[model samples]
Target: MVSQVVWAQVRSKAGRLVERPVRELRGERLEEYEAVWQPPRYQGRRAIATWWRPADRARHVGCAHLGALGAAVSLEADRDVVAFASWPMRLHWADDAGGYVPDFFVRLADGRVRLLVCRPAGGSPQRWEAAAELLEAAGKQADWQVHVHEGTADPVVFSNLQRLSRWRHTRLADADTARVLRKVFAEPQPLAVGVRESGLPELPTVAKAHHLIWTRKLLIDWSSPYMPHRSLVWAPEGVV
Candidate 1:
């Protein structure tokens, strides 16, 4: 005789269980497990992502505004983070108040899931403290770390990142172009010379340089305001 377990595996089009009569369950209501929830609506001033999520491997698309603060977090997460989500899930805060959706959910290389929110540097303490307390309660319930980032990002650095990220989706230039750039950077040099020596048009050359910098094939002072012409760049040791 076919067991009830075998019969339970058959599901109908509407996600209802196809009940093949079995001894263990004669008239039991066959209900399928619920499907994954898709949010019916989203909140926030919508913006498209320039970067990918490390955790879910989801390619770029629309998401909540990263602005200055969120932009800073995105770059760091790409480097040190194991994975992250931008407002991926909702956490219910209380019965009366609506659910809170964190700005980011990061899983660090150290295996911690951190919930992060960004606000203005001069935001109200009382409101933020209340938020922190609510997040603390939420953390206790879900066993995750909750953090708040309250500040404006450095204007120069942030602007430079915005410019550089434009080349992130660009394809690498030719082999000869890459070779010339590498040879120029065989010693630390102003990126301008490398761009000129590539013999490519300045636009494409600069774009290639941007890609190289983004992929870590080249290094420069990311600490300060970045200038394409005068920025010093060096290839990793032994990099041809």
Candidate 2:
């Protein structure tokens, strides 16, 4: 009989598992596209607009936490459950496809797909709410999962989460990236009296966060970080 231990050990290492070939995202051939169905809407990159200068640090730290958790989490702060392909995953649904290319799209080894939506602290709550509504409607039809997160310094808005289930708030230890993002994600308002009473440090911009109306955490499997971007399935180049 084949030794299960050997097989398991081999699979644990990158480039050792015998599996299906991975595809990359390149063009317009995503599993789904907004232009084909709905009119696009957007004026700028959501991350830069939302978190502004600190967006990259916010995303890097978030992805690092996700990586440490050993889940298949990709980065995206917008769109449906489809994975964002990049560091600061901002979701976009364009009616005409006349904006920046998507940040990144991820395809895990297990074949699960999700979209990432990054929301900055102190953005137009209206837009976030509108996007949440669209995601809820689209989720039922597309059978996708959506994950939303706020930059560390931003407040996690809880206004429209009544419809979601199993929601809980948890905080992770701040990392280097979180430290760098402090200036951008930090809020201008004073810390709540309660927060001060608890003896925590004054909140930084990286301290604020909001939950996107999503079912579960967005994921990207990074067991094999050394693998070339082209080796992965669902790369940007492969999308079209």
Best by lDDT: 1
Candidate 1 lDDT score at position 172: 59
- For candidate 1, the lDDT comes to 0.54
For all predicted structures, in order, the TM-scores are 0.61, 0.27
- The CA lDDT at 66 in model 1 is 48
Q: State the lDDT of candidate 2 residue by residue for 1-240, as single tens digits.
A: 111111000121232323111121222223222211111346853432111111222232222232211121212232333332333222223331221122223443445554344443466897667556554433333343455544323222221222121122233323442333233223322223323432445443113211211222211122322111221211111111
Q: Could you list the CA RMSD of all candidates, in the order they appear?
A: 11.4, 20.3
Q: In model 2, what is the error at residue 189, expressed in angstroms?
A: 45
Deviating ranges (above 4 Å) for candidate 2: 1-104, 152-240
List candidate 1 segments past 4 Å from native.
1-73, 109-111, 120-125, 170-180, 199-203
How far does residue 70 in candidate 1 sit from its true spot (Å)?
4.1
lDDT of each: 0.54, 0.28
